[model samples]
Target: MTTKKILIVDDEAAIVAVLEELLTEEGYTIIKAYNGLEAISIFNKKQHIDLMIVDYCMPHLNGRRVIETMRQNPRYSTTPVIVITGSEKQFSNFPEDSTYQFLIEKPFNLERITETVHKLLG
Candidate 1:
């Protein structure tokens, strides 16, 4: 019954705020990052992250690069990542052989993400 740590990365402050509140209430330890570069900084210091929920489009660095960066590190190599994006076309731009676990379309259902997190972390 150990607590799962979730890193939520998005440049949108409102989106980050809502997700942080939702996941916190679900009993997961939440780590907040405003963008991909910030997410990397956070990851460097907190190497034991259980899961990562990253938005695809952000300034400085994008979610795909952020996840790729994490995957290169031994500590987070197998950590599950859920990528959120608004455009399916843009999603297709990511590498076909990438290590990310899920690609969720933007304006996603809260329950869907919650269920996904539970399924992955359980």
Candidate 2:
């Protein structure tokens, strides 16, 4: 089977690095974006992204805006998104009908993240 491609958008370099290493070890290809604008640019160029993990507090556009923009495009309307944030209360501001089904709080365990990713990708 072909390896899945996952896009990770976050402003923290350490978070991106850790996710890249973890996901790569799991045999998935990862695309990293530092902010929402960069994430959108990557999405537009590499349109085959299989999954996306976004940080809610990113600069330039923020995660909700990124997801909303992608959802507006027919190509990504049904794509699965997992939102990670230090503040869970911020999730209430997301679109009422957004495609995201998972919210992972900050300081998450690696095992939990891996398990969630496997479940979502399946």
Candidate 3:
């Protein structure tokens, strides 16, 4: 099977590193971004991304904005996205019609994430 590429966006370097390791071990290609702006840049440069795991709060552009920007391009309109947030209040601010396929709270279980990834990319 072909390798799936997943873009992981978070302001925390540790979160990105851990996710990178975990997902890489699952055999998916990972693209890392520390902040929203860099994520956007990477999104533009990469031809195709199978899925996204984004932090709800970030610098430059929030996860919502980043997802919005991505959805603007028809190619990514239906791409599976998983939003992770430490603050429940941040999630409350998001509209009901969120584009993301899943919402995972911070300090998430690695196995849960891996399962979600497999389900989404299956």
> Which candidate number maximizes lDDT?
3
Segments of candidate 2 deviating more than 4 angstroms: 90-92, 95-97
**Cα misplacement distance, residue 85 of candidate 1 (Å):** 0.8
Question: What local lDDT does model 1 show for residue 14?
Answer: 88
Candidate 3's TM-score reads 0.92
lDDT of 1 at 41: 92
Candidate 1 lDDT, 1-122, residue by residue in tens: 78899999999998888888889999999998999888889778855799999988888898778988898888898899898887663456463446788878889889999999998998
lDDT of 2 by residue, 92-113 (tens): 6664444686888898788888
lDDT of 3 at 105: 88
Task: Go through the candidates in order and give each one's C-alpha lDDT.
Answer: 0.85, 0.85, 0.88
User: Which pairs of residues clash in candidate 2, taking residues 3 or more apart in a chain or in different chains?
Assistant: none
TM-score of each: 0.91, 0.92, 0.92
What's model 3's overall lDDT? 0.88
TM-score of model number 2: 0.92
Clash count of each predicted structure: 0, 0, 0
For candidate 3, list the clashing residue pairs, or say none: none
Please provide, for model 3 over 1-122, each residue's C-alpha lDDT reduced to its tens digit, 9 standing for 90 to 100: 88999999999999999999999999999988898899788768756899999998887888888898888888788889999988774456562356888998889999999999999999
